[model samples]
Target: MTTFSRRKALALAGAVALATGLAAATPVLAQDCEKVDLTFTFWGSVNEKNDIENAVKNWNTNNPCIQVKPMHIPATGTNYVQKLTTMIASNTAPDIGYLGENQAFQWATEGKILDLSPYMGETPDQQYIKSTIYKAGDTLMGTGLATGVMLIYYNKDVFDAAGVPYPPAKADEAWTWQQFVDNAKLLTKDRSGKNATDPAFDPNAIDTFGVTLPSWWGGWYPYVMSNGGQFANEDGTALTLNSPEAVEALQGFQDLIYVDHVMPNPTQTSSLPTGDVLMQSRKVAMSMDGMWRVTDFAKLGINWGVGVLPKWKTAETVVLSVPKVIFSQTKHPKEAYEFYKYISDPAQVGLFKSGLWAPHEKAYFTEPDLLKTWVQAEGSAYPPEAMDAIVDYTLNHAPQQAPVYQLKNIGQIMSEAVEPNIQQIMNNKATAQDAMDKAVATAQPMMQGRW
Candidate 1:
């Protein structure tokens, strides 16, 4: 794959996305399903395809009557969407597929996906992360097979060399907003041994930046939440991103590049896979990114330390997980739910073992021995001890967030109206308040609709 394609793909790596304006999935004509041979499909690399296929094999061993056929959407020019949209319209969609959690809910609003609640057994004591597995208004849309946690990653070598203590692993020990920024300033340095705080330091022609802040909402949401800002009112009905608190949070983040001059500018991080690369090369000393990076970062072999994001009003970060969904058109609803349950069985992906996913099942976070299964997996890249604080912070402290998923068509609003302004802030062309005001002006009417 081209680097650009890889970057595009990785952008959708932890958080997810898709388009609007595609006609709603058509109502399927009645069809018999005496044989009950269901189709399961998704878009992924060969290895991911194999892992999914193998998971299905395990499910098939017990359920002999319901045979599942796996389908891999070919990688060609947004081919996954092309095929899925066509299939849904033509009444040939798979019984189950990876309809990114956010997109699936939107399609479900348009009558495309099956609500698995009826087929669900009574809620078990141990279950998936409540925020991710449940839908807006309490509808059970699909099941999450994996989890992603946003974390601040620091280069251990850089922290040691600079004599700056590593950011704390525990939430209680987190640095405050100003403290975090100040530490970032200290980490930033030029080739001539000058930090960002130095009188002679140059913002331009910098050797290494302290951190890299992302304009993407997933990355920005934490800062906003930490500052007691709200992107939307409860139940996802209103835009509050222009609120004073949010504006200040956004300004603080933009200042990392523009005012404090501690972080890389948007142009510098435009290269593929963003944060991990800068840290690996030591071009950046620290980065704010999701833990799903372990699958890739482990290979870089850089000595990195995980740190807890600082609190302002209080600690907060983005909480989201991609889900596997069942199509409403599936004639075999029972069989589809059965297979969907198996695929989303949490243990299937082994992502936690690989350090690319955090624990979604409550047990993994609450019980030490149970949690060790993945954290201490052989050759694991994640530091079991260092990650405990993050896990505690995620489970007990981090608020369950809606992001672009709970509210239908919000992703479109974010892309068309919100992202440009975020870019403007990063480019130092507009203040966060001004940019957000313009964004609210542009997006408010569209978002007012229940779509």
Candidate 2:
């Protein structure tokens, strides 16, 4: 046998993957698929476990020889990456798995995962609202099994109780920043029934907040982008949070908690746990978060409503992607690819309507039936008007990229230069200008290591 170094083997495998897997009409590799039990690893709750099991059962019913077992990784954040990396290095990694945006870029670049070029089955249709589903460049890093977008989820009961109309669903018709603030003022009420706009309204006595966004950068990133902020150069090489637009965006959120006091203080939310509970319990009337929360809200029977994000200088929100990648060290690439394909298949449109995900395919967005399959649910899902706006307006209007994700060592960069300073801004430890300046000062030096 010819000796092949590991990296050479990696490159050769990628080439082979591209060669044998045709992008169209490619037959499954004719092999004994049932005798093989491929273990797929992922992270999530029991609900995810159930979803994967359903998908596996659907695929396994016909292919008895090839069985796919969903393995619960029981890990999160850095721990997830570390455990999976160790598994890969030890040649004991599961056959296929989920790769977050940071890892998809980091690992696929290093050839630690399979490129699915040949097995993709078709040239992707690009007219969908959330186009560029995965930023794989020339490599088939993996298909994002589901695409999710940032939008506002408000409690319909809260809106009705406050006598406020629903927020706009269309991006073009999005509320201006001031209008959003004004609406929030109207929605917020204190224990004594005073609104935020009332001079007698005490922030300390707020019973229901007007709005609240997730604490993470994902929630606030769009604020900067919509305001024409360039937080960094197109490539994530340097920090620009100190720029006027970026600072203004950061301050805009800070003002909500401190100056305007329309938002709940971050320190006070430890009891609530999630945005869903905040809405369900009526502590917050409007919650800005990813569409995934629709699952939990729907299950809880909350009278929830969906709407596009409130635009600042322009209408935009960040798109969240979590792609599926095959480990290069897998012994059963064909069986693994089959399982990956089954779960990642665009035709599994039912996942969308269930509230766990949104469509990652152009057809689902363009074709009405496909869109309805994934989008229309009686409750805890987007209503008809909101569904149309998401498909026709928000999906197309959301930004092409998440500014903060344009980085190498994204976790490290964010930890050192971003989150802490952002905490300062949010907690009122520092003004947006000071917090951003500090973040830039710390993070600028680390950009030297970026890809």
Candidate 3:
């Protein structure tokens, strides 16, 4: 029943607003006397930490009534969910926190996250892009967390040097999967100057790879999506990993290695850094990657050009976005809702958007130069058309797949069971079909017990 006033919350986020030209301190009224404290938990590196702290400072400066503290938990891998779940069980949960697109829905279904439908109503949903939020059921309006969009990144200098054409600035001309594979085959070469398809090509003596696929869950999303595979049924109850579409998708992904022979083997790939795949000595011509590539890898002296992900049956890619959820156990739901409204304002949203995190709102997409300016202000790492391609790809082709789990413990169980299978497929130790089949068999027991 304790509420942090809206005006106070605005003052609290002043630093964030100021950075985006909305930072003026708001007047604090006498009614702002409540001793309110809220904790925000999220995962990030030092630079990302600074960006978030700056946002929190802005909020504190403008709002004198509420005291908000930010907590950084190093949840490398699935530890984020593990630690947070422990906190919730003990009723020591933060008032508001970030949740992944899928994990958010699982938490929400467990009654851990507050339902914002009453708070959001039609106006907020109107501004929301359907692809950003996860849905639990067909008619359920909002039950999920954040979304991320996938993109193709090509080394422009490498392309130009190899005499291959660059990806177009817009999605309308984006290459299909076949074109992408052909380009990869063309760019892949050994020291003796043989492409992947050349009879003279030698895999053992290869010096450059056509592309790099991260051996993680992220890689599977595009493969399955591009091949017209659905990870789960529309209703989110049954597993769909054995479908022909999923098998086809897996075959396509595996083809990058076993069939096309353009990608590096899993052993060599495990040594790669998070975003610097293009920085390898045996040059990488392209990478199926995330938008974070611009902010994370642009400064590495690689001439990278981004394009919409190559299409298969349809031009689709997976998007990962986070949502800030209010705890159902919070003492001040109204005040928390007020904070949500205050921080999500366009000006504040713009600051977060500029910092490599995509905003959930739609207005940010229309500003063609917004993404380019944000990344360039730090340094000119990506090519000029990077933002154009990302925005075009996300707006036109990104579709939302629910990230929710069927059972309460499903988050931990699925992460544990699936990551290794992903590793197995990426390493070619097992076929995508074989790996996924084992994964389903393992997870089915857990889901049945929980759902």
Candidate 4:
């Protein structure tokens, strides 16, 4: 095993491209099993890979029927699908794999994955929420083994030093958009120690940003939803990003960085850690990011707190969970079904939860003593109360938009139209309306052609 020092880890993290080379060799057999070896392909950072491996190792011990190996693919972002498609076509694809939830329904439509309904029906344990397991068409996919919630994460040390009250924990108790803006203004300060309100507060000399929202798809989705616009139509038949509400939402996101001057420009944010504005620790007072940020923060040993995202008129945010899927092409269908069933068992799911993946098990949140035991044993990195708050928010308030599947070339369109214009808006190159108008004009026809 390679030992990573603090300096080395930071350097590695800083220099690391999200892209990783696919490991050609499978892991050595840890223990013998009756079933054939199965490889699992996934895309994430080294830390994420380890967490997944830890979960798989636990599953491996008692189930002498199968030995599972993990393949850590390079972080090409959305390019992962393309890579997996190539591997699948080449017949070298792993028996079990990971896919974007948005893409899963589409893939299922093409018969790319094994229908897990039979296996799920046989399981007596209520390991998953029925709501979470359904696909875009409300077809039962597989058990949504783990989920990610879009949330507001704050630096406790920064809030403490700045003397601002930390954001609230419960989703229902979250601030309104204006109140959130006001709090951010209080926390944002210039090099001369003037807050955002002071006339002498130099935007150029601003030492701490009120927030750092990235141009990435995940970062921008909340803004779109905040204005009651979703990326796709309800049935996933068409793109709706050019809707009036979407225009308003995109404009607001632009104003935060451009007009307010309280956020970093696109170049600054892109060059920042992992192209993640929220991962900058003390540099940003408040930022919206995925729940997995907690797992990343644990590595830095920073005291961070999770909070509900401020509400629009409708109080909504992203709640997506990617699951391990069995490919339709697997040779050993019976054994494959058995393995999927095994992973979905509550005990196996609890192992995954211990690795910081959100539990789809409603019991983790509903039962008091069980919830307490979960925090003590598996959730030491986060407050159990905060996790519960997030879970509740997802259950009650989570929006059900089709995952960016309306546009065939979503990743490209985002880079070309969305990111550039959002960048221009942040740099004060254009007004929210003008930037959005141009983005809509460019993306509308482009997306139409693809669809």
Highest TM-score: give the candidate number: 2
RMSD of each: 9.8, 7.7, 6.1, 9.9
Query: For residues 1-451, could you state the per-residue lDDT of candidate 1 as single tens digits?
Result: 2324323433454211111010111212223434468999876544456556766676555455677898988745457767888999999989988766546666776778777667663444244455556453445675565566677888889988888888788877788989988888898998887999899998887888898766678778888888888777675556778999899889888888878988877677765345777788888888877766665566678888787777777876676667678888888887676566555433333545666556556655655444555666466667644454557767766674656655656767777778889889888999999999998887776574332
The ten-residue window of minimal lDDT in model 4 covers 15-24
How displaced is residue 33 in candidate 1, in Å?
15
TM-score of each: 0.80, 0.85, 0.78, 0.78
The residue ranges of model 2 lying beyond 4 angstroms of the native Cα positions read 1-34, 74-77, 121-138, 376-380, 448-451
The clash count for each model shown is: 0, 8, 23, 3
User: For residues 320-400, could you state the per-residue lDDT of candidate 4 as single tens digits?
Assistant: 666568887888766555555555433334433443566555554555433443344455556555654466776666655
Winner of 2 and 4 under lDDT: 2
Best-matching candidate per lDDT: 2
Per-residue lDDT, model 2, residue 161, is 87
Off by over 4 Å in 3: 1-35, 89-91, 122-126, 134-147, 191-195, 280-282, 329-335, 349-355, 366-388, 399-413, 416-420, 437-451
